[model samples]
Target: MAVLVVGGSGFLGRELVGQSLAAGHQVAATCLTQPPDLVGPAWHALDVRDRRQVADLVTAIEPDVVINAAYRKADWSSTADGAAHVALAAASAGARLVHVSSDAVFSGAAVRYDETSVPDPIAPYGAAKAAAETAVTAICPDAVIARTSLIIGDGGSVHEQRVRALATGRMSGVLFTDEVRCPVHVADLAAALLELASSDHAGIHHVAGADAVSRHELGTLIARRDGLDAAALPSGRRAGTDLPGPLDVRLDCTATRQRLRTELRGARQFLGH
Candidate 1:
């Protein structure tokens, strides 16, 4: 099977590309700013925001599976509109699509969000993601929208780096004790996404870690996992502060667990206690 991974240079995208290649599948990857470090997959320069480029690439590649993982912070055109373009192109070309989404799509009003939970985004990023999910579903009904959370693994993710900085005294800000998320390991999420690319399951799926933890707890866990000073990381609350949106967007992955054989382990298991 030929697989096409958009945003192959990104943290999670890179892992997907590598895993796809290791699984002996023909892989093609796309990037905008930085080129992918691996040499196995075929690389292409792509800007998903451009409809023509996306269509042309999908037409030319004709991949069996196309995973839309491309994202840009604070760029609606790239994050939201780009996802629509990709979904349309994939649907037109008759390729299966796996659209990566975030847990931020929900406003933390509910105790826990399931696949059927309605999106009530409060922040700009969350709103954009919700819009992308809508566009992708409307454009391609068969596409799987994998809603994941804070991706951390092997000391490379942005969340882990921030915790590291705080532990080392390079940055001085308390992590929020009120804000909670189901932080997933990048490798586990990547594996599940690849598996879903071939499956017939469609619509929104919560493909995240099993445990829901607060931001402060997550930071402290990362600090301890990396042998850093966990006590140095201070804790804060999101109740009174200017922080926007829902404070606890915990995802329920029971549906995902039944769908795939991959185990979406929690941070405590992956990072170790």
Candidate 2:
């Protein structure tokens, strides 16, 4: 099958491109800036915030499936408006869509969320993601809205890098013991997303890890895996801080898990003790 992966330069996006190539699929990928060094995908310079550009690119490629993994945490135009543009283009091209979402849409008041939970975002990023989800759902009825969490790789994820930086005193920040999330491996997430894209399943699907761990605990795990000093990785609490976000948001992926052939391993399982 021919596939289009948006945000090909990103950590998760890179994995998606690689996996698609390995599956022997004809792949086209888009990047906001320069394309990556990966040789398999046909690369395009796309600004998803630009509706005409998005539509034109999708029109030119005419891919069978479009998997949107593009997002900017601080920019609403990139996160929300971009999603709508991509959705519109995919729908117009009659292509299947799998739009990636985040567990940040939850406010943590419920603590644990499922596919049925309504988004009640507290921060701008979360709100933007929620908006993206809404647009994708309404625009593409057959699209899969896969809401994942804290995508960790072998060592390439931002969070994992942050942990390494903190342990070596290259960065200065405390991993909040109270802030928790179900972190999914990048490979697993990318594979599951591809699996979902190829399937007929539609609507909201929670595709996070099985284990819900605090940021500090997650950092310690990273440190352990990387042979860093776990004690040097400072821990703190986000509860009393001025941070405007959830303290604990764990997605319940039981229903989604039953439908997928990919195994979404937990951080502990993937990273080890």
Candidate 3:
């Protein structure tokens, strides 16, 4: 299969690109600035915010599947408009689209959300993601909108790095005990996405991990796995703070899990805690 992984330079995108290449697919990737020593997949310069640029690239590649993993927490154009552009381009190219979304779309008022749950975003980032989801769904009704949670790699993820920094007293921040989310491993998420891409499944699918854990507990797990002082990690509460996000948002992946061959293991299992 010919696959186009947008934002191939990102953490999740890198995993998806590598895994797609490993699966013997003809892979092409897009990035703003080219990454050095990137092997296998053909790289293209793309600004997903530019409608014409997105359309031209997808038209030229003519990929069988397009996975969009591009987003900026603060940039609305990149997260929302970029998604719309990718969806339009993919639809124009007659390619299967898998738009990566976030559990942040939910406000966590109900705590646990299923595939049928509507987005009630609170923060700007969550709102951007919700807007992206809306645009993707409207543009490509056949597209799979896979909503995932905190993506963690073995040791390369930003969250893991933060845990290390906090444990080592390098970063002055606290992992909130009140803030909770389902954390999915990058490999599992990438594999599940590919599986969905090859399948006939469409519409919203929750693709998060099996376990929902608080930020502090997750940090402790990371610290323990990395041989850091778990007790040294500072802890706090986001409830009373000025933080703009939900306290607990758990995605129920029961339906999605039944469809996927890939097992979405919990953080405690993957982190080896």
Question: Which candidate comes out best when scored by lDDT?
Answer: 2
lDDT comparing candidate 1 with the true structure: 0.92
lDDT of 3 at 51: 97
Estimate the TM-score of every prediction. Answer: 0.98, 0.99, 0.99
Residue-level lDDT for 130 in candidate 3: 95
Candidate 3 weakest ten by summed lDDT? 30-39
* Cand. 1 TM to true fold: 0.98
Candidate 2 residue 217 C-alpha distance from true site, Å: 0.4
Candidate 2 wrongly placed segments (more than 4 Å): none
lDDT scores in order: 0.92, 0.96, 0.95
Output the better candidate (2/3) by lDDT.
2
123-149 per-residue lDDT for model 1 (tens digits): 988999999999999999989999999
Clashes (backbone N, CA, C under 3 Å), per candidate, total 1, 0, 0
- Best-to-worst ranking by TM-score: 2, 3, 1
